[model samples]
Target: MTTYFVGFFLGLHRICDQVMAIKRGNYRKKKVSSTSWKKQLKSWSIRIVVGFFALSIFWVLCLKFINPPITYLMIKRGFQWQSEGKGFKIEKDWLPYDDLSNNLKRAALAGEDAHFMSHNGFDTDAIKQALEKNQSGKPLRGGSTISQQVAKNVFLWPGRSWLRKGLETYFTFLIEIIWSKKRILEVYLNVIEMGQGVYGAEAASHYYFNKSAKSLTKKEAALIIAILPNPRQWDARRPSNYVNSRANNIVRYLSHYEIPD
Candidate 1:
């Protein structure tokens, strides 16, 4: 999997460089012989296409097998959250899809990925935006949707390096291909890191709402989703003004967003 992404990224880098050169009108001036250049371009094109296909296939396979316990292992090995100074703890108690208010799903999806149902695994536009913004300063935008989060929590490690990213890409493809939207959302609810040493919807609800996962109110659910971006610092129980503002925005938009029957 590493090998595949390495090749794919390299191929993409070349494509980007070539496109930049073309934009600068230097592509026609390069002396590397037309025949060789054409052949190389064709080869890279094929490779990029094939690599993406293989990546999608691998992601589907992993969804069928790989799970979130890998996150537990990473935590057990003393992987602390660097930014927030916290650890994650998971507790499982599956909430029936009905018990939770419909707005909860809308809030999470809107907060994370508005187009979650449409994208396969990755949101290229979101990634592109993140890249551009991160280049100017520290990265603030994360393009990961519920599906990718589900994959990361269940199958991938948290190294925050190239290797972890590569594995994450592979596993993101896995969950998108193998699991239903419901399954992906379910696992996300059960495994997402909510606070310092706090994980799973049940744990979060018990701690924040003084209730079970099944009893979380729409406002409470919105609060939970609001703190997800940086659960270590943000507290759903006592949200800052920003989190509170975002939660209300989610509620305002909820009626338009529909949940599947």
Candidate 2:
């Protein structure tokens, strides 16, 4: 799988470089012959592709052991809030998989991805359902799995562009191949935005309930998970009727949720 991706990326990179070279008049300029340009482009492209692949692999491998201090989303949101003069400060604390409450994990699985333990990286059934709903003229929805969410939150920037989506898919496969399920869940809980300027289970627990994540009750965990769809818009600290209702639904679902061993 890794070899296939590397080869594909290299092929894509070579095509792009060739197009760029042509656009820059390498084919027209008498100083460089077409044959010479082709050889040079191939050589340089191979070198650049190898360098990028090595660096990417090294980075992903390192994350298996080292926790990231901050994510691109955190920095981007922080800058935006600062520009708006919202007095935003990122509050986050990294907790190991065992340190967080079981309810929180179960609640998250219940609220976000019910088949998280089974799905590889994408959830086909959820995607098919979303497509059907959209076709029926309902509001558009995403079928992004927990793995994809972690990929976007940890490595990629947010957007709906094809380029962004493609990169998200690439990273999703990488993490699923390299990191364990527990590690993926731990990273998701620790980095996912819970509220404005609040991140991670520990930070969210403290911000909303003034307690540690491990001490959160089932209801509290559900409430925290309820605002996940739009944490900035939904306030877990002062949950509206919709948020409260969603929390209740999540709690009910939690009873049937089985945490992956």
Candidate 3:
């Protein structure tokens, strides 16, 4: 142990000597100016930050508009005091466009954002309503579209924090400019959390229906859509009477709107 410590100290001393020599050589030679170093650092810093955000945005955009793997709903960390923290595993599964019915689409849209295709990215009217309701001591009206929700779920954390909202807004706009409407719907459907540890349509289908996402029925889809408000609290397969009524309402409302198609 004594010899090991002495050797370790000697190695550290040699490494320090090598670093000092390198610094001395740097001082002796013509070096990059501090201003230039700062500029370069700032440039690289911007590139790193922008690159990270841009790539995440692009991945979301492509996954939304194109047929690809659902990007956001996988659980990385387990639950603490919650219901034993549920997470999902994607093992060669894909949600086909045909498998999801129109009723399900409209129901999801109605449950999430009523005016999905009409707005750009931000739902200012809904935000205003949310704010107004908050002021008036009522329930908040969320104006977030499928894409905005995708942005929040995929890119940003779940919260009512100002910072998270700002970042979500930024990502929402970025994805709107990059992805199409169809892609947004696809991503939202596939990435939504259906239950504890249950994520994506495929995982939820397997957990709830014992089938694939593409084989899901209208009733099954309605049940899934019904629990969108709070997936963790309400089970989709065995929903309560209120959940059934809400699902029925979504189905009824869906008949009036042409959702996803």
Candidate 4:
């Protein structure tokens, strides 16, 4: 009877060992599967990032020679106008680079980015000043260069998020490298929103001054540019005291500006 009991105990021990072995095998398989999934996800993420980089570069290169028929901001503004119960209007007329008035260019440079001719795609000093001022709890202001504005208006949506700003920086760098200074200014003048649903120099010139873009006088150009920060709020046709002061400042310093050849 004792020998029989011992044999039975040995059989139980063998069964337990087999079950343990199976559990170990399953755990190993699970570990391998998890690792494989992670690797696949990482590989796909890398491919997507590389693909976006390549595509963005190609788009920028094409715009170097080709004028964009419309921009993201234009479409966004169109929708906004429609939603506001105002009839959707997109007034933009593309003009040749040479047809753009020198006075308008000078006013833009003087009022918007004084160092436009010298900076790469950003103005470090202005950014530093803005940061310092914001830290002091002043009104929120931006140090976006004209190049950055072109990037945001042409390729991106309106926002103050970090992602949008990061993309703006990327596009700005790309345009500075791919397009000439003249081309950058041309695209900026052609795409920038001058009023609610009003885009480009030609449209703003006709709407505000009843003149063509090439015929904008010095004071007329300065007035138009003065309302640029908040064109929807300020009217160039009837400038307020503040707008008039800003326009005067821009005109006073207009001679100091040098347009890119």
Candidate 5:
């Protein structure tokens, strides 16, 4: 009987040793697997960074020559309207820089960004003023320069995110570097939303006044520019008293505003 007990104890000790050896082997394999996963993650991150920079350079170079057929905002609005069964279609007519009315151009500069010709991609003074106003608990006003507007309207969708703002800044810099002031204004005039479906000076003129952009009168141009702050809400054809007042102010500014030659 003592011999039988001794044999049982020896068998139990051997089983425990085998289990511990298996656990140690599994722990080593787990450590190796964790290290491999981290290496793969690092490799993928490097690839993404390289790919992003390559694509950004390509996009900037291509836009220097080609007009964008559609913008992110155009696509977003189209999808939204379609989902709501509004049958809304984007109306755009790409006119050359020469074909656009000079009055329209001046009106835009006066109403939207008076320092369009001088600023790089930002208006520092305007930004400071806007910041001060907002900090004082006043209504927030946009300090975006015409160059920034062109960048956002041409290349980006509407959003108030850090990522979107960062991308906007990058594109703004790229456009300022790659495009001349005339080209920037040309794109801005052609792509900015004028009405619900109207886009560009030519389309806005045709929709609102049944005339060509080149023939828009000074008042017509001012009225068109007046609704730009909220084109979706304000109608140039049926301007509110407030809109008319703003248009008059813009017209007054137009006398002093100079278009770049």
Candidate 6:
């Protein structure tokens, strides 16, 4: 009877060992599968990021040679106007860099970015001043340079978020690298909003002064640019005292604002 009990005990121990081994094997399989899935997920994530970078670069490169038929801002504005029950109109006409008025170019530089030809894509001093003013709780001001503005107007949506700012910086760097100073200014003048429904220097010149862009006088150009900060509210044809003041200041700067050859 003792011998029989010992054999039974030994058999029970063997069965327990087999069950534990099977569980260990199953755990190893699950761990391997989880690791493989994680690796695949990481690989796909990298691929998606690479694809986006490539596409963005291609988009920027194409714009260097081709004028964008429309922009993200234009679409947003159209939708916004329609939603608000306001009639929507987008007035934009593409003009070559040389065809644009010299006075308009100078006014743009003086009023928007005085150091357009010298700076890379950003103006450190302007950014510093803007930061200080915002810290002091003054009305929100922008320190965006021409290149930065072009980046936002052309490729990005308007926002003050960190993500939008980061993308703006990235596109500005690309524009400064891929395009000439003349091209940058050309694009800026062509895409910048000038009135409620008017876009670009050509349209604004026609809409406000009833003249061609190339014929825009210094004062006319300055007045148009002066109201650019709030185009929908201010009319260049009937400018307020503040607008006139800003235009006079811009005109004064134009004497010293030289466009790069």
Steric clash pairs (candidate 3): 64-183, 65-183, 79-85, 86-197, 87-197
> For residues 1-261, what per-residue lDDT tens digits would candidate 4 score against the true structure?
999999999999999999999999999999999999999999999999999999999999999999999987788788889998997789999987899999999999999999998999999999998898899766547898999999998888888877998999999999999999899999999999899889999999999988899988889999999999999899999999999999999999999988988
* lDDT: worst 10-residue window of model 5: 132-141
Worst 10 residues of 6 by lDDT: 133-142
State model 6's lDDT: 0.91
In TM-score terms, candidate 5 sits at: 0.83
Task: Score every model by TM-score.
Answer: 0.66, 0.83, 0.70, 0.94, 0.83, 0.95
Per-residue lDDT tens digits for candidate 2, residues 8-70, read 999999999999988788546755686788999999999998997788778777888999899
Which pairs in model 4 have colliding backbones?
none
lDDT of 3 by residue, 71-168 (tens): 43344423332345333333334575566656567767777778788888877888887787688765444766787888887676666777878888
* Tens-digit per-residue lDDT, 1-261, candidate 1: 999999999999999999997866765566546768999999999999899778767655654545434365336533545334545433445465556556567767767777777888788899888788788667345777777777666766555676777777877766666777766776677677777667777778888888877666778888998999888789998999999999988777766665544
> Each candidate's lDDT (Cα)?
0.72, 0.89, 0.73, 0.92, 0.88, 0.91
lDDT tens digits, residue span 1-261, model 6: 999999999999999999999999999999999999999999999999999989999999999999988888887888878788887778899888899889999999999998888999999999998998899766547799999999999999978778889999999999999989988999999999888768899999999999889989999999998998898899999999999999999998898988966
Higher-scoring candidate on TM-score, 3 or 6? 6
Clashing pairs in 1: 59-173, 59-174, 67-154, 68-154, 87-197
Q: Quick one: ranking by TM-score, best first?
A: 6, 4, 2, 5, 3, 1
In model 3, what lDDT does residue 36 have? 80
For model 3, what is the alpha-carbon lDDT of residue 234? 96
Is candidate 4 or 6 superior in lDDT? 4
Candidate 2 residues lying further than 4 Å off, grouped into runs, are 1-32, 135-140
Q: How would you encode candidate 5's per-residue C-alpha lDDT over 174-248 as one tens digit per residue?
A: 888888888888889999989887789999999999999998888999999999999989999999999999999
- Local error of candidate 6 at 253, Å? 1.8
